[model samples]
Target: MLGSLLLLWAGLLLLYFLWKTRRPKNFPPGPQPFPIFGNLLQLNLKNPMKDFEKLSKRYGKVYSVYFGGKPVVLLHGLQSVKEALMTRGVEFGGRPQGLLVNDINENKGVIIVNYGPSWKEQRRFAMSTLRNFGLGKLSMEERILEETSHLNSYIDKSAGQCLDPQTLFHNALSNVICAIMFGSHYNYEDQSFQSLIRMITENTKIINGPWGMLYDTIPLIRSLPLPFQKIFENRDKVKAFFQAKVTEHKETRVPGKPRDMIDCYLNEIDKRGNDGSSFDDGFMMVFLMDLFVAGTDTSSTTLRVGLLQLMMHPDVQARCQQEIDTVLGERKQVCYEDRHRMPYVQAVIHEVQRYGSVVPLSVFHATTQDTQVLGYSIPKGTMIIPNLSSVLYEEGQWKFPHDFNPSNFLNKEGEFVKPEAFVPFSLGPRMCLGEALARMELFLFFVTLLRRFQFHWPQDGGEPDLTPHFGIIQGPRPYRLGVRLRGRQSG
Candidate 1:
């Protein structure tokens, strides 16, 4: 009887393997996946970006790769990405369920939450509220400029000394969002805010690291204690911090009058009042967390990488400063509107975003329903990985796609011209919620800093490494810059 049972189990295992390895009819082609393990073995979890790029060459763009028996479509190049994210956006606009990020977030936030009533409701509300609170308006620019002043002072103190800008930029950007979220900004010396920034940095690193890959691929091992567990721990701590803020808001908030995002949300909840809407305290906590993380990380990382690029290319830096000086002319501060008059400076900032390619993969998107990309059928709920790096660095897209050159954004007339492929912010209905605020902040901060200080690689610091340490967001490897006050500095 024991021998018979073993034989039956062996046959069942074989059948399971076959089923898992099989692909649906008309599915985009890719490397054959291993049973159970799927294509996990084929990727370098540490950083699968280059691996994905290589596979695109072998399997063509819009190919599929399996993660633990689940097939995910990887969209490459400008054409495929545009078709999926723009032409057929709604059909390909759902977040993947049961992933590490969704699980950690409990799928309540605006980012990873599924596309449906709740997502629609939260997104609409967030967008309107942000605009009302001055996202793209002059009021919002004022808020960002205020934060830029703090950043200038912080850097001013370290002038002519070797200083690492990682934390400085992170803290500055975090405080910018904090004002919008909490109606106030934290002191540069605040321990709690610093801790919060550290957690966000660590979480972004882990979310794209090897452990995050392992957690996503193998369900059987998820319950085991592992480094990925730290993600959950960090999530809990962040949730608690944001939750406390929510509790405090509830105490001080007045109905029909909103101070910031939290106050606006509370007013919204009251207006909806048990209407069975997605508006509630539970979702609000995660929503706040999402806004904070989204608002802070990418822009900050871009600034860090932008500084590195400037240090490496002093000519680019000097030219930008010259443009800034010519345009501002003793103004003592730069504004968002000033970008129009300073085409070269605008080009350099855009190039920084292009060269940085900070959020490379662009938060994983899933198929909301059955869809077709370039005639290949993608089933409902299939995972979509848009290789934005492909388009950003596509061979024919820009004059110098592989190198950092402001000319990428400049026309022969020396005017700033954004190419169709310059999508550092992913294009779609579900594109970055904080896009306008980020653009304004990047312009104000970069212009302000370049006007006030000249950033250069330290004398002892050998060749600056242009290669960014890959994460969910790419950032420069830790390096310090020597700051010298520019002639006629901005106050």
Candidate 2:
């Protein structure tokens, strides 16, 4: 009996391994899978960017990798990514289902929901509603500048001291998002506000770390409690926070006069009442949460990366400041319109984004129908990972693809020029809707802060580590910088 049982177990294992390794017809070629583990064993779950680059080199620009018997097509370089995300966007626009992140998001919200009529409707409503609340207009600039003032004040309190500006920057950006979503801002010292920022930041790390990868690949261990459970816990807490704000808005908001995004969405629910529209209180809560989280994380991480790059290359910082001074010419503050004249400053900001590649592997996309990229077949439901880092640093696309030079964005005449490969906000139907707002905020906040202060690496801090703490959103490793009022020069 014992011999018979052992033989049966061995036979099942072999069958499972064979089934997992078989490639679909016309599928892109990839490295051989290792039994049930797939390519997970070959990757550094905590930071797989380098591993991905290595795989691409070995398997060509377009190749496949399996995560627990599931094949994910990785698109590298400008040609392949453009073909998939732009040329055949609608065909490759659907979001993957049954992943850990999908589960945590409950498969709702504009950012993660599968492509369909409902998603299209929600996205249109969000874009229009945001515009009604001053998006891409001077009124939106005023809102960002208000937060800039608060950010400046906080830095003023710590001027000439070595400090980690991570939390400071996060708070400023979070407040900007709050003003848009909730019609209010929070003080830097508000504990509740701090908690929200903390939780969202933590979620970004956890969702892209080892546990997130494990949860995505393995089906057997999901039901058992694990560290990844923290993601769901944090999600619940954030939902509760949004729900409270919704309750407050319901009690106080006027029917016709919308105060912010929330109020506008509430009015939308009333207008679509019983019309079979997807607009409702619960959907609104997750939608608002999506806007807030998406708005805060990417922008804040970019600022952190910007600060680090500026400090590491003081020459770049000084040049940006010189341009800022020349353009503003004693003006109290900078505006979005001023960016058109400040070419060098604009180049630096764009270079910072390109160098950082914050959203390296952008949110995973899946093919909506049977399609092919670069002559390779991709079946419906195959996951697509557009390697933005490849395009950001690809050869032939930029003058200096591997360096952190603002000149990459400048022509011989020193005019600002954006390369087609600079799709940091991504491309196609599912592209980020907040691109305009984010660009405005980055310009306003970067210009204002550079004008007010000069930042440098701490003298005793030794060699600065430029390595990023990789996640879904890449963030600069924690480090301290010495700050002083601009033009002081003397130590």
Highest lDDT among the candidates is held by which one? 2
Error of 1 at 428 (Å): 1.1
**Tens-digit lDDT track of model 2 for 1-491:** 99999999989997888786788888999988877788889888778889988988988999999997899999999999999999999999999999887887777779899999779978999999878778878889999999999888888888888767788888888888899988888988898898888887788777777777788888788888999888889989999999999999999999989988989888988988898877887788779889988898899889999999999899999999999999999788888999999999999999999999999998899999999999999999999999999999998999999889999999999999999999899899988999988999999999999999999988888888888888788888888878998867635
**Model 2 residue 261 lDDT?**
90
**Candidate 1 pairs with clashing backbones:** none
Q: In model 2, which runs have C-alpha deviations exceeding 4 angstroms?
A: 489-491
Candidate 1 residues 252-353, lDDT tens each?
988888889999999988999989999998899899999999998899889998889998899999998898889999887777889899999889989999
**Residue 154 CA error for candidate 1 (Å)?**
1.3
Cα error, residue 462 of model 1, in Å, equals 2.6
